[model samples]
Target chain A: MTSQSAAVLKKKSDRKKMGMKARENVYQGILWIFLIVLALTMILPFLYVVILSFTDSTAYQAGKLILWPEKWSTEAYQLILSGDGFMNALKSTLFITVIGTPLSVIINAGLAYMLSKPIPGKGFFNKYVMFTMLFSAGMVPNFMNIKQLGLIDNYFAMILPSLCGAWTIMVMRSFFQSLPVDLEEAAKIDGCGPLKIFARIVIPLSKPMLATMTLFAFVSYWNMYFNCVMYITSTAKQTLQVYVQKVVLSSTVSDVVDLSMDLATTVPQEVMRMAAVVVVVLPILIIYPFLQKYFQSGMMVGAVKG
Target chain B: MAKKKVKYKATNKTLRQQIYEFRWIYFLGIPGLIILLLMNYMPMRNLIMAFQDYNPHLGILKSPWVGLEHFQTLFQDDKFYNMLKNTLIISGLSLLTFPAPVILALIMNEVRNAKFKKFIQTSVYLPHFLSWAIVASLTFFLLSTEQGFVNKVAEMMGNEPTAYLFSSKWIYVIIVVQSLWKSVGWGSIVYLAAIAGIDQSLYEAAKMDGANRFQCMWKITLPSIMPTVMVMLILRMGTIISVDFEQVFLMNNAMVKQQLEVFEVYIYNNSIASGSTQYSYTTAIGIFKSVINTGLVLLTNWITNRKGYEGVM
Candidate 1:
């Protein structure tokens, strides 16, 4: 009797285990479907752009929407890359990113370092910083101020106004606060003053936060269209993003059909627009992987411990 | 050691020791203060431009005082009502949709498989890296009248294709949907961090009490992240009047002008109009906007506080 009862109990437990395993499998299947759908949404448009860039002008004119191009050609890429307009804009974008990002990171880091220390009138400075974040004098005054400062129509115009971002400084300050004081104290005892300690000891240890700030600043400066439009009047000085804007705006045949007859045969408007986008975006996307480790880890360092 | 102590005592006897003690503290503040004064405080003096007929030639002090004339003109303008309406509608829709990321994060936290969670996360984050210009172009290609993917699919189904972008009726809806698609993944990062910080022992304890995954999520997960959600909601409410100027400006045309004419774009239009460089008038409108935004943020925080969570106020 005891052996028979034990066998029945074992069977019941095995059935429960089987049921749990089935549920787990079902959950896994649902998760896979969700992820696949998300992946398609994220990647399909980019793929579409690439596919259209290769399609010939004749195929584009015929309104063919085939994913696999009926007539694959490199006319769009050849036109955009070989053109003087694309090259100048590309150069301006790279210049802005390289010059503006480091300037911002260094200046903001100096301000952050100062604010992070336990010093006299620290509360006064902190409040002043917070005030800027909450309220600004708005765009028109900012424009006038920059113009008066003689930054308009100049590269410094683009870089200076955005250099000392309040949020970034605040983030860096909090990040510095979270670092142990012992590291800096030891350096101080070894004949290092504040500046030397910041340069020699603190900076090397703060690579992740610095990297995150650099990437953010680089992207912001690279993608700046408003500053280019507002301040930059010369066609030659326009950044890539602003150029992309102009291209996309004028690309539709309906808008520019009356401009000229010769313009119609230059290239398919859709292909040119896509090619510009690809050029504008490709560099940043390529650089993103290098900063991926910094982005995921450093973004959270000083965000919300409070 | 005795000689060193004697030297220290000689320095302490002098006024130099007292000065040195406080010197480092004051020195640390000057660089940051100089930047703040130059960048932030100096521009604040320009706020006075709102009260004057500001002219570049006359400068701030020499510009004619206009008193409330600019504010009066701003109120009388026909576009003011429409601009304010559009701003509120777009902002309200965003507030409604902003919680989607938080919901997504909660769902993600429930996933037992680590690899699948990472896949979904990495894929969702791609759109945040894309600029509004690219996003707008993508939308146009997908929703264009004749050659768009959506229209093509509709044509295949024996139905007429609807003009999605040009339709005034659908413009706001399109803006909200686009905003959601671009930001939902990145916005959820904060909520995910808050979720991850929740104690693992809570989940273990719940499991031991016969609670299943769904029950644990409902009873433990949602409550744990409520404070972060409240803070984010309060902060978003603070910027209610501000719109993503880049996205709307890039996407909009004459077709959907009525629907898509947000306050930011409205300001841009006024700035660009011939002889519309009335800096005072523009400054007045800007001042009004900042006031309204600040008031709304405070009001929302008040509401949140009444609900018993510590709001941003």
Candidate 2:
């Protein structure tokens, strides 16, 4: 009787373990399914934009929406690229990104280095700086200030106003503070003056922060539609975002159809708009992955420690 | 005694050595100070425009002092109330749901497969890079009445599709969701980094004690990252009044303006809109907004600190 009871207990325990393992397997399956669906939802809209970019205008107007192009055509690209607006916007965006980013990195880095040091009255200076960041003069006052500076309608209106971003300086300062003090001390011991130490040792070591700040600056200046809309009344200086805005906000589908004489206009304004979206953002999406390898490390440096 | 002598020698360096020792420090400070003065501090004096009846022809100080007349005008305007209401609502929603990124990071941390995890992160973050103009356009494509994706899906499921943008009731939802879509991924980065920094040995110890993955996360991972979440939350509360002006301005139209007009837009439109450049009035509105924002930051910081979390203070 004792042997029989022991066998039954052993069997019961084995069955329970099997059941738990099976439940665990089911749970894992459910989790995977959820993640996959979430990822698909995230990617599908962007994919649809790309698909719409290649769809023919006539079918697009007819409301033939599909995950794939119904009839293929690059006429939208042709129209967008040939237009004077597109070329001018592209030039303006490129100019801003190329010029503005480096300037921000240098200025922010230099400021961060100085602020990172523990010196006399550093607290006062730091408070003065962070004050502008936390409490702004708001939009109108800043606009009036720009107007008073006689910066309107000039490229400097865009570049100069945003040159010294306080957030970037703060981020860089935090990053600089986190660096080991030994590096600076060792450089000092090597008969390195503060300038030489800063230029040769500090800047080289802070490359990741520099890269991250550069990316931040580039993205910001590229996406600057509000500033352009406010200060740039000139059509010649409109950026890509402004050009895309004009296209999207242009007269409705019927208005476009009425204005154009061409039969079955090869590209629908809707499709053209999607194509424009693809064109405008494609550079960053393409460039970011390459930059990501660098960006990941840079973000790690700022983020992980904090 | 020897160490004291060395310290004295260092302190008593010649004038040339003293200048050379501190020269790079000054070098770093000067250029940065100049740029800061130009870009930040200089424009700050224009806050004087708030006090005067700022007239372009008369110049800033040359204009007569209006004292609190502009502020009185601002408080009297009914639209001012609406702007303040809208600003508070939008910011409140953001603050309430700000922990979403932390939640998302926790979920991402659980995924075992590195490749799939990366794919999820990249897709989630892609929207952040899109400009507000682009996002607004995309929203129009997906949510518009005639040919939008959501409407089409609704039709297939046998429901009548409503125009999401035109309805005043739906405008706030649109703003909040768009904001979430754009920021959720980027926002997760800080928490994810915090999670990654958790000591591996803690998790191994949990496993040894027969703790499951869920238990391990609840006990170990969450607490480890709580400090990071608290810091982010404090920073968020400090700017709870300031909404992102670009997205709201770009997405709004006549039908939704009443519901969607935020403080930033209220200030920006007064100055930038054609035939509506009321300089003194806008400046006063700006000053009012700044004072309120500053007060809120300090108050929130004090409250959080008293409650025992490490806030911005």
Candidate 3:
């Protein structure tokens, strides 16, 4: 039971390790290399966008892979910003994200909280929501309905149509149900009404989940494309995504002649596209690391053991 | 906000009392229900447009009823079949690659070094946050005939520059790769969570039984996460008829447009694109697709349940 037996056991396992260690090393080594390469592939496209955006026209004109620039330049940014359409798009995108996110979170939280309660008709309510999750009306009918609501060309067309979805509500309902009921029980005993208990105990206690939902709503609103396209017809109401798509995918730029010979010469289309890509994604990239845990936690809810 | 509400005194409340007690909660749910009614249910009601001659001035209700005419057009149209085929192929290819993240997650679970694992996770997850617009731009930069990074590198290595952007040959492959790159990391989170929820004791027991690392993973980790894998598979299969229009549309060049005319893109083109608004026909097309998707979901859910796992539905 003491040092002598321990020594024998250690030696026995040590010998086994000696044989298996080499194979394990190879396995582990290959795993690491495969993962490292996979990670780099994910990262490099974004890096490539950022790098090419900043690369001076000279390096770009070299017809070589521009990994690093001899001289970093902001001409692309200057040119993209110089366009009123791009600026308008950015402003509207920002407007949608700001307005949509808070409204979305509150709606989701309220509906989810009510679902979490032992309210009458709750089961029917759940099924009703779940039905929406399973089958959505196709875009045309949905567009017609939105148009009938007088949301066409309206910002609410973008915001209201997709403000709260059933899948999100279900996920959030689970979150609410997972919250400790003891606080509510105590609040009830102290003669605190349901609203008071929810406003005080539930809201404060569920900050992490709320934060995660907030970020998700924010991201969805920020990345919104389908709604923006279907609902908002006017260029003035178009979003960053629409703007970026026009800049990035449409090779001819629609009216290249209007680009002006001087501007085209100074800042080529490719570089401008790269810069637009960066501008569109910069906020997410900056906040991503800080909010990464929230994302994981939200998904892994009720799954984590330790 | 209601200051005059009295404290509950009843030990066993009647239905009326219970309903009255929950009134405020019901009040909280009003705005959401209204939104759902307007945004979701109203659209569903307007799905009647698929059977009618939808004239905007007439509105959906007053529009002339043309039962099954739009549906007939949808089925008879060659473009409809083409769109359906493209949608199926793209979604099917993507669904086949769904397990990529599961494999990645398993490999990730094997890494002993926490820091290195964190680095990999962080790096991989970033791509998911990128909007389709950025990915499309990135694709253009990679595939551009002359100044593209890939072509430039190919030229530097004395290889021929392939017409990646200007050709339809690689459109499907391009879509698959783009989806994989964007989703694999985010998709793996669920599998990783499943792996995390596996009993650690099972692994230790496997180790004690002289099972090697691969043996342990195969016998223990793999079997443990099967239910989760099944659930995910069923869920994915349900939506296999629908493809992401944003990604396909944004990535579409004239070269690839014919090859990549998915249902959503077709709808967008006919109903919402500049100068076209064939609402009745497009509505019929959408209804047909959604019906197929919904049927697939129910069918897959029942199959999964028959196999003894809890159904995703």
lDDT of each: 0.76, 0.77, 0.81
| Cα error, candidate 2, residue A62 (Å) | 3.0
Clashing pairs in 1: none
For lDDT, the strongest prediction is 3
Task: Compose the digit string of candidate 3's lDDT tens values, residues B1-313.
Answer: 1221222233366557878989889877778888888888888887888888877777777989999998888788999889988988999999989889889988999998888998898998888777887788788888888778899999999999988876888889989999999988888887787788788999888888888888888888889888888778877877788887889987776778889999888788888774435888888888898889888978987877888776322
- Residue-level lDDT of model 1, residues B45-156, one tens digit each, is 7889899988778889898998988889889988878888888898899889978988888877767787778767776777877788788878887888876878877887
Model 1 stretches with alpha carbons more than 4 Å out: A252-266, A295-298, A301-306, B1-36, B273-275, B297-313
Candidate 3 off by > 4 Å: A1-16, A250-264, A295-306, B1-14, B274-277, B311-313
Better of 1 and 2 by lDDT: 2
TM-score of each: 0.90, 0.89, 0.91
Write model 1 residue lDDT over A129-202, tens digit each, in one string: 77777777777767777766777778777776777767888899878888889988898788777777888777
DockQ of candidates 1 onward, in order?
A: 0.44, 0.49, 0.56
Query: What is the interface RMSD, in angstroms, for predicted model 1?
Result: 3.3
True contacts kept of each: 0.32, 0.51, 0.68
Ranking by DockQ: 3, 2, 1
Show the colliding residue pairs in model 2.
Answer: A57-A267, A57-A268
